[model samples]
Target: MQNLTPQTILKEKFGYDNFRTGQLDVIEKVLAHKHALAIMPTGGGKSITYQLPAMLFDGITLVISPLISLMKDQVDGLDAMGIDATFLNSTLSGQVQAQRMSDLRSGYYKMLYVSPERLEISSFFDFIQQLPIELVAIDEAHVMSQWGHDFRPSYLNILPLLAKIPGNPAVLGLTATATDRVRQNLQQLLGVADEDTILTGFARDNLALKIAHNVDKRQYVQEYLRENKDQSGIIYAATRKQVDELYEFLNKKGVKAGHYHAGLPERERQAMQEAFLFDEVQVMVATNAFGMGINKPNVRFVIHYSVPGNIEAYYQEIGRAGRDGLPAEAVLLYAPQDIHLQEFFVQKSEGTEEHKQNEYNKIREMNAFANTQSCLPRYLLGYFGEIVDHDCGHCSNCLDSREMVDVTTDSQRVLANVVRMNQSFGKAMVAKVLKGSQDATVKKYDYLMKLPTYGLMKDRTLKDLSSFIDYLTADGYLRIEGGEFPVLKVTEIGARVLKGQLVVEKRVNRRVIAQQKVTSAAKGLKLSESDNKLFAELKSKRLELAREAGIPPFLIFSDKTLMNMAILRPQTDEEFLAISGVGEKKFDIYHKEFADVIVKQH
Candidate 1:
């Protein structure tokens, strides 16, 4: 091992002047031979934590990753930087795998990537014993937890693999999203204590989180794509059928798009992934299986075609956008019925009764997030055990200028109806009874018909009553029990509302809350006309250079770098190097090309 610090290695090899937040600390712990569990947001430079240590260690570092594509991307990136890295996965031929294993035993590589399932093979485990493994890094560590949103059974095999390695190499667990419960589970599984675990804040200020309720989703998405034609993004659907339909719609409309689902042949899926990564396609319509290991840095937006089953899934999916530190958007087009689809999935999923109930609770929280009027970022942070002292002005709730109206009367009526029915029914039945439906179920219960609170909301439409009921439930005025059949019940908070001791207010028309005009791409930038023209010119130049280099545009220079170049009008090599992301390697290659553009314009 070389006597070099992480800072020296980072500058000499990676060309980055400084470490991002929480990176140096985690790297220090690992270098000290202590275990670490890092929970960082996407694009948080997590790979460097282990990669840096691998360079400084005397022996090889084995990285157990969750996805083949992710490992390929990382290895390719490392190779581009002239670093020695390789991966062992199903994609490799048997002869090639043998050669790589031979190289591993010969100590020809510094880092090796393999799937957790590979560790379960007796022959593979024995083969690895020939090499000195100094560190074992587990990526997407949350999968080790059975309660996590993305649970993989094969991940549990890693524990035995560690025990077989000689000298007991240090361990590092890395993940992008984990709630407090999942975090604890990860710590326990990885044998790391509380102090060794570092949680970087989940706030992504550059991402504008917006939820569009009850809109014509197809029309809305079409319009959005039309406006953002030059940008790259992902549109995530809830089902494979939806993915195929949206892909067809976009293709018929002449949008540069591709679709992906598990049903597609492996070759076709690989083709689609490469097309999107190379910018041959501007939009990728996929199911949730698409983004676990995607390292595309310049994705400008992510649109959820439907609400995901849990907040953790939603957060991780949206984290794919704004990775280049440029402003991006996360738009969720939701309807009340999306929850039913997720509930059906939970019921069908094979798990214990407690696991199913946990899924149900997470689904309820997801529903609340979709309908929340509070700050979206605040709610997400609180869900992950972080307390933000103020609202994040970037989300839809903070941007909304609508007024709140008192709904105390409606709340009291809903609570009274729940009580009068003796809290034995569900939301649909309560809504039906409140709206005075003459259906057989309502008519069969004579006592429900005789209650004074029955038909109290007859003047309102069922849709409107249902909306208010959802609002009350989300606001804690009511609670729903979990099971195959959920029963509606009044909490102490609901009783207080019924007794007039508490007042409730909510946005008047929940559907119309997000009806304001969709924000223009340049709304928040506050750029002048000349700056906007310069930005366009710089972006065109970036595209031209990217084509010549045969790499993603962001790899050459991020959108944020171009934006800074446009605004600052760097006139010399030194000035260009001063811009963020313009390190020595990039400055040496394209400084003059960018400087000439700026100087000519100025």
Candidate 2:
């Protein structure tokens, strides 16, 4: 544990020559025995921050993880790298737990991953006091914040557990997605200072963010899978029924796929996870419960079968794909009506009124994101408080070649109606009044018919008017007051638009276009026929080696690594080592097998 820097640990153990952004800084903070709060996107190398420190520290690092699958995946990955790591969770038998506890007492492990609930046992706290724990790393730290998208009441126990420990150990809180408020909450709860919170940009340039509105999602997904058959991907539905239906549809269509949801038995879920991780299945259809702790790096696409609960959940879910810094697609199939499902969930969620209101606000933002005409990446980044001067140039909005039409007249009509209603109504009421609805609610206020703005937009459908209201609200022209039933009110900007002081423009989806097909490999890496053949051969070899070694294929070699091998045609051990991801350890294990493939091709 002495004289070991993060750089050497990364190279010798993890087979990487350089650290991704924000990793080294977090590692340095941990090494210096300082508390750190790191907000890195998924696949941004968060585990390495504390893992490297664990290697360099004289005592063990205790990781507070939320999910058993996540803990197992991390521990398995570390064990594969020749690092000593173990997880204690409900999955272990009593005997196994006792053995792990005994090992902890004897100082036999460098890292231990556990759930926060485990800390509630006073005896376990006593056991921890005996261990020389140098650091306590909290993964998915956002869950500790009740304001976060994913809130777990159990996570609140972490601070109490740390308090019981003998000495104040360095604390590292990590999450893939956290807003300024959530970050502040974590900082306060973990006792980390503002300066110690490190946030890398949330933008993932390699992910092509697209929102496909008003399309036959099933057909679109089928076509996408057919186009990218050789690649691995995940399709996330919002319910167990949808997961089953999608899984059945794909299976009937002859796609090698599997389904996962909470409804499935524990064994079945684990099998499905292992199947997907081992590349035995090319596509996974699952609910939101399926992917929190998965570490598969070669997923080429992630299609949201339905809109997620919030932007934070959406970003974190899509972050699962393209972990290897390769081009990937995150296509969200959105329908305006689909929002009802989320609203229903929010209403049914176990939380206070304020929590529900916060969730509703987040859902509104997510809905705006789906319908935004601006660059998807820019909108998402802005939501997370990151300002980008330019369009991401890769998302659906930026890539869309459609023309934006001036909707000032329509905007004025909507804003004027809100004013006529005295700004005390909701979006539905405004839309209904504008569309000249004779419904009882609209008729209840007989004065509505007398208003000049009433029936002014009768020629427009209610759906279109509703969408416009949504746009106006999101564009800062209008605001929705929070409550059981929100009232749409005009902001200063809306007042200006109503007074003809400002103009508005929005993208109109004139007609739906076919989704663009991207390659399975990294974008822009076109290989010739011979090179393609060599690439396939190398991939087959890599998969075979992965199976023989009982590990995930990406662990053996990422798709990027295999592509480099095919392109570089590295024929010797030394030549292979020059390729990225091929360090001395990997070279010692895989060079002969992969190099022979290249040499034979030559």
Candidate 3:
């Protein structure tokens, strides 16, 4: 362990009793000048892993990180605690960046974060060598692997460049997601000794996971938001296009909403982010880009619009919620197509077959969570090597009805239909045949010949069948050979199920009601009758207030302000603040007129 006191520094600055799980050990190792790898889950106090020790240790701790947003967020948080911290990144103007770097060199800061690409710049490297480099913290060190979720080609080149620095700073690698393979890769890449590496098994006990299967996912999401309107939350879409579309839809439905995605222009993305941070917007519909390093303590829920590629991605995404640890929700609106799509995404990742196989194992882990009869959190923790007691009584599968069925025959029938139908049928078509929907397409294809199978599954809607198919795909029993139209191919599991050799137990789908719009039922006062009442009230008040404030009415309040005041009919100063155009300055100036009119109205 590193010498000196984390307690003293933690108490003085952060006002905390102690560090959370896995923080103190990593901090100690770093201060001792030993190379270390810290693999803790998101919201697991990962920043404190390096940051606390940076304050206690000798010399400037140069922290390498991704995400300019996260850097600014952390720096701002540090600044709030009366710590002197600054970051150097693309967001800073060159002139500003140079001055900040000069300050860092001249003993102005104990910790500084620069991007990996910044490390390779020869001038930056030379200047760093001249400075007193005590420790180096690599944030999101898993990006070193192209196989890792957030691969950065630049990060792959950082290790050799760090070696060129006059003295290698004690290396501390930090990430929220890493298994044995990821941890091993991290150690080898950072050149850390095995004994120096620290692992806090991933376990988020606060989050309550729920799976809404075979339901209209969009409708389910709408209801969850409507029911939990008092609390702010995030709904993560899988694509930028989905983010934009959902944002527009929520705005039309009258939710105070904004979106964050890399696809937007930088200005728009930042504005949306700032809006959410400032609480100017109630809900932020976003892609994965939005949650990388956000530290909003009051996020009440996180809804995934789609399943993530693997458990690591799932854990990291849901970990964004309930950071204040107040029993927040992590809901997955899963269906059959979702797994196929995820598998297709995995198959498309840029890696060798060996690398693809590695991703396959990760995906299999995620699927196990989705299809498991055990507790969701328990399963999740076990995947990360943590021991969890019995069912959490919080996950969807945990609270769900457990009427397990012998679905071997059902699975085999679906598999045969896909095989018999030329192996190129779309999900809807496969589902329609199974449900005996007898849609024109199903009748056109003579799917009746395969009747005994999917035909009996008809009472269960295609949505239900689709959910089952998703599980089958995730488990590798059914392959979605991605092409123009992804065709389902039977795997060895599917073939075994056909022969009544494999038994698969699944929970029947749940019925869900779509959310109704939670908008104000009353229409606004009409502009026609509204304008006369507004004008008369404003003119009368202006005359009376003119006698009091002894100023002309126009200077006291603008016409727009008067119009809004009349429309809202605010009964008090607090209510007056609710008027659209009445900021503090205008309210103070024109208080008497508005107050008198409001008082007289009753």
Q: What's each prediction's clash count? A: 0, 0, 2
Ranking of models by lDDT:
1, 2, 3
Candidate 2 at residue 249, lDDT? 90
TM-score leaderboard ranking: 2, 1, 3
In candidate 1, what are the lDDT values of residues 1-602, reduced to their tens digit?
46788999999888999999999999999988788899999989899999989999989999999888678888999888777999999999999999999999898999999998888888998888878998999999989998799889899877867878987788999998899999999888888999999999898989999999899999999999999999999999999999999999999999999999999998899899999999999999999989887889999999999999999999999999999999999999989888899999989989889988888988888887888788998889898899999998879888886658777888888898998898999888899999888899888887888889888888677887887777777767788886768888898988998899998878653323221111121234456788788888888888899999898989988877777777767655555666667889988898877777887789
Residues 392-490 of candidate 2: C-alpha lDDT, one tens digit per residue: 888888988775767898899888899999998999999999999999999999999789988988767788788878888777788888756889989
C-alpha lDDT score of every prediction, in listed order: 0.87, 0.87, 0.75
CA error at residue 256 for candidate 3, angstroms: 1.6
What ranges in model 1 sit over 4 Å off? 509-602
Each prediction's TM-score versus the true structure: 0.83, 0.84, 0.72
Over 1-602, each residue of candidate 3 has an lDDT whose tens digit, in order, gives 25548888788878889788878888888878878998887788888877787777668888888887678878888888876777888888989988997898788888888888888888888878877888888888888866576678898877887776556678888888876777788888888888788887777778898876557866786777789877888888777888888888878877888899888898888888888888888888987888788888788888888777688888888888888878888888765566677668767777667666666656555655676555788877776677767778877777877445556766777888777667778667778777777667777867454556556565566766776776677565787654334567788877888777888766542212100000111223344575567668887877777768788877666666566555555655555665545678987877775677666764
Q: Indicate the TM-score of model 2.
A: 0.84
Candidate 2 overall lDDT versus native: 0.87
In TM-score terms, candidate 1 sits at 0.83
